[model samples]
Target: MLDHAVQSLREHGVRMTPQRQAILEYLVTEHSHPTADDIYKALSGRFPNMSVATVYNNLRVFKEIGLVQEMNYGDASSRFDFVTSRHYHIICDTCGKVVDFNYPVLDEIEAVASQLTGFKVDRHRLEVYGTCPTCQAEQTHTH
Candidate 1:
């Protein structure tokens, strides 16, 4: 996946610097859907000179090249997701943990929406929020 992403960037004429590669590698290796600040903190030990701005800029480039998607869940920071395919997110309300789940593309919803509204629907996002297992366990223990 990392190799394919690097190739895609190369085809787009984007130069692959070490910092950019590290950022991309982190995204590819970690499915945590991290924010720019999260990424900066995680990689700072290895990349002492890299700044948060560098991570943000590289993330922007990755998004532009269709290698990643930025998800804003009404949070203070946007989380970056490595593009795979059509999927939805299940978020833990208690801990703000985001997990990906797969379902068939809701083309029927788009069709119905377009028919009812007379507009072309490009895409849709679905998120389910609930307490995660760890959070549930913690709550149970507290109660």
Candidate 2:
């Protein structure tokens, strides 16, 4: 996956710097859907000279190249997800965890929407929210 991502970046004329590679590796390996600050903190030790702005810039480049998708769930910070496949997220209301879920695309809804509204339906997102198991356990213990 990392090799394929690097190839795509090179094809798009983006230089493959070590810092950029580290960021890409982090995104590919970690499914936590991290924010820019989270990424900076994770890589700060290895690349002490790398700045938060650098991480943001690299993420922007990746976004433009369609390597990642930025998710904003009414949160102050945007989390980045690697574009592996079409999937939905199940978010933990208590702990803010994002887990991916797969289901058939709702083509019928898009067709109906376009037919009724006279607008081109390009895509859609479905988010399921609930307390994660760990959080549920904690809540039960506390109560």
Candidate 3:
């Protein structure tokens, strides 16, 4: 995955710096859908001079180059996902965790919408929100 990400970045003429490499490595390995601050906190120890702004900047570049996806969960910061394939995310409302799930594409829905509105349908995203099992268990214990 790291090699593929590096190749994709190079294909887009993006430089592969140490910081960027570290950021990409973290994103590819960590499926937590971490925010920019989370990334900075995780990598700052290794790259002592790296800043949060650097993480944000690299993330922006990655998004622009189609190397990563930026997800806004109505939180303070947007989270980053490394997987570029078409998939859906299930977010835990109580714990604020994001998990990925793959489902068959809903091409019929897009076709219907395009036919009804006469507008070209590009793509769509679906996010399911609920309490994760751990959160549910915690709630049960507390109650």
Candidate 4:
């Protein structure tokens, strides 16, 4: 499926440079939301010839093509997500881990916003912040 995605990206004039391909492949298999620095670290070993700027440039292309999503949760570092579907996120305040949450209520929330605000709504992102289960467990143990 990802190969098809990459081919589609190339067809749409994405350059398809080797570095860009590597980035896309990495994103498809990664479950964790990774920052640019994280990506640079992982690729540095194999792609010593590739520059961090190249990763940023390719990420921009992926975002432009809607193949990747960039997220900023009031953090200095921006994280990148590969899952592009309409979904919400739960960000762990302790670990800074991000997980996808598919809630049907989000549609209702969008409807309410449109009804009350009288604004044309195309899309929305809902980010919930809290300690993850593992973090909560650790806190309990410590206390």
Score residue 61 of candidate 1 by CA lDDT: 95
Stretches of model 4 off by over 4 angstroms after superposition: none
Which pairs in model 2 have colliding backbones?
none
lDDT of 2 at 50: 100
Query: For residues 1-143, could you state the per-residue lDDT of candidate 1 as single tens digits?
Result: 99999999999999999999999999998999999999999999999999999999999999999999999988458999999887889989888889999877564788889899999999988989999999999999999
Model 2 agreement with the true structure over 37-61: per-residue lDDT tens digits:
9999999999999999999999999
| Local accuracy of candidate 4 as per-residue lDDT tens digits, 11-129 | 89766777787788888888688998889999999899888898888888888878889999884588888855678889999999999878886688878999999998888888999
TM-scores for every predicted model: 0.94, 0.93, 0.94, 0.90
Local accuracy by lDDT, each model: 0.92, 0.93, 0.91, 0.85
Query: How does model 1 score by TM-score?
Result: 0.94
Rank the candidate models, highest lDDT first.
2, 1, 3, 4
How many steric overlaps does candidate 4 have?
0
Cα distance off (Å), candidate 1, residue 86: 1.0
All candidates: CA RMSD (Å): 1.2, 1.4, 1.3, 1.6
